[model samples]
Target: MNPRATPTAPPAPGPDSLTERYVHAVTRRLPEDQRDDVARELRATVADRADSLHDAGATDDEAERAAVTELGDPDRLAADYRGSAQQLIGPALYPAWARMLRILLLVVVPIVVVVVTVVDLLDGADAGSLIGGAVTTALGVGVQLAFWVTLVYALLDRTLSRAEAEQACGGPWSPDDLPPVRTSRGSVGDLAASLAFYALVAGALVWQQLRPPVDGHPLIDPALWSFWIPVLLVALAGEAAYEVWKWRTGWTRRTALLNLVPTTLFALPLAYLAWSERLLDPDAVAAIQQGWPDFDPGVAHLVVLAVCVVVWVWDVVDGFRRAA
Candidate 1:
């Protein structure tokens, strides 16, 4: 008489079981909306396959192993169901990456151009050299931004492979995740006014040089124009940068500290010109004196210099007070 074969033990139950783990592997990568339905279908399919194998004379353990093996790697199965194969930066993250790149290019390129141009000009560079330096700086910054941003996203895509669809987005992102209402240190009107002021000052300075000379003397000393104009542009650029920073980051102790550099850079030159009695074109001053015989030019110059200094001090104090 042939003895009956000993019954083999079925797979373990609970989280440690092969079936639950495999199901979890697949479902974790799926969206919550699809997870329940897909899990049910997957479990049903696996059970049906196992039962068929059991009827074909395979034991429970053997059937379970065969069924899981037939489905192949858990990761591959998840990818297949999601229809997203491995990618450097998947479709899920491509839009974010593109948006970031656009913002960086728009913001960084202009800042870099301003900085490079200022540096070159301060070094007594020719116009050609200043333009070339700006271009080079912008190109370098662009390449660095592209490379690092892409590399980071690629790493995130690969590392977040096992995360749930929503979880892989870095967090549970929802409409509620957005700020309730936007707030800033400065308003749009303030930024616009500041920008307009810079434009007007720059235009006025340039016009003085371009306009016909008054009695063989320009509104500004041409020699001072060659040197001081660049200095003024640099100061203007620094102030513009601070305005942008304030608009974006709002007031902060850090911003207040940063304000010191630009104010000092701006005031020092104007203060020097005022003290040395060379800020205005002598001919222009003489013409003014001719019109007002009682006017004391030295006193007027001292008053203007004092006003500039006071303005700078007031600006620095205001920045810190706002931060507080």
Candidate 2:
């Protein structure tokens, strides 16, 4: 043997080859329950194909490349493997969904803005605050609208597709099996008004924290700013989410019942704070007391707590009434 001959490199791993990478890409999109089985099947298929190519006298690299090529694009294969197609809303439902969403955003949103602007003007917010608040409400409502509509349609797509698959597999299929039409649609005006009110309250809460008015400290409890503000914001977000859910599904009994969670969260802390005399600044209360000699801070706090309780209880009752 010649001493100067080149040393050969070891062959790359068969299982750790491009075929394995392609299989990994496909399985990762699948659910955890099915991923292992899908991955196993894909690997076996790739291995069998590569072996066939090898039998035809192709080298390992060539056979592997040909096998992978036969499988095609990973994303397309993944879409095929998924129980539900990778889409926001499928073609079958896109038209109705798009039409509904378009109408909601176009007709409902402007009316909301105009109505909010009028209410703010009546409440005496200046030009800057009014415009800012309106814009915030529009943006928040728009985002909520798009998100919820898409989510509902996506759920529908999955459900309808799954039902079709089950029927194909000899599962029961009947119009008579459909759930009762228990859905109750809210008026567009009502939905828009509720959404605007939520946006206004949330914006006012944050605004006070960032920039209190020139004459007075914020109405919110300053002592609780570190913790309560974030909690309040989360509660506000939850309320907004509920409003969107209500808008999408209407005043169903389930939604009526679920409304209590956010309502309770929003009211409880404020009620506690008011009753415990932690809700407002002492300085602000003194200023108010100076103007009104008969003012009693203790009584005022109790009144506020009572009002909050009443409002929330009424809101829950109203939800049930609407559902009925």
Candidate 3:
């Protein structure tokens, strides 16, 4: 008698069926930022568990149970996704910072837009002029936004990457475990360059005061005369102070921040003074040529020079000490 032909077919995967469905459902629901990576990692982890279970002689149904069990709970898994490297600055914090920055930009941007539009409109602006001005203003804002975002994201990436690498090597994840940035020390050449640069600026200010090439009379606002010289003096002093700070600290945050202060102080104060004077008399642009002979730009400036001298001396000593 012919034996009944034995049916040979792959076994139905009951456990895998459930696990696969669960994984797909949960991964599909994962927040967009972490969805891709979470899905990939979870897939591999679950599959590996299935293989191990099969080796242990468990049925497909049982194997799926073990694998899903090993994966932990779905809510926790998604939360991990949020906190994971997949979401640096995290799902939560990133959104908040973005919101705040956007609000700030939007608020300031509208005011800028109105001012620009008014200026353009006053300039007999046609469609082209108005659109162009608006577009240019928007572009400027966009550039600033891009800069801030790029900087923030870069910082997040560096900090997170380092943390992950450390943790992967079995070290504890410490946010403060970040590596310190190396500061640049000014060589003798650098020191000479710094000194020469400030000296030139100082000389230029002197030239402007003694012999400005203005055919029009100078505007004698106590403020205008009071402005540039002291700022120049402060800048000179700031440069020296920065050098000293750098020498002592080898160019750390202190040096960088202190160095940067003069730029804002000098430029911003000058801009504000021009604005104030312009506000004092917008129609009298010619009034700029008047002299503030009674105003002592020189005296205010001498005090500024004294401050700078102090800074310079400190820097010379500090630089030598640090270099030593």
Q: Tell me how many clashing residue pairs each candidate has.
A: 0, 0, 8
Candidate 1: global Cα-lDDT? Answer: 0.74
Per-residue accuracy of model 1 over 4-36 as CA lDDT, tens digit each: 342543443466666777899888988889898
Stretches of candidate 3 exceeding 4 Å from the true structure: 1-7, 10-89, 103-127, 143-151, 154-268, 271-324
Candidate 2: list runs displaced more than 4 Å: 1-184, 210-214
Please list the residue runs of candidate 1 whose C-alpha ends up more than 4 Å from where it truly belongs after superposition: 1-137, 140-182, 212-216
In angstroms, how far off is 134's CA in candidate 1? 5.6
Per-prediction CA RMSD (Å): 12.5, 12.0, 15.3
Clashes of 1: 0
Winner by TM-score:
1
Better of 1 and 3 by TM-score: 1
lDDT of 3 by residue, 153-269 (tens): 546554655555344334653554332444544566777777688668656654544553344322233234344545545555555445544554464333444445554555455
Judging by lDDT, tell me the better candidate of 2 and 3: 2
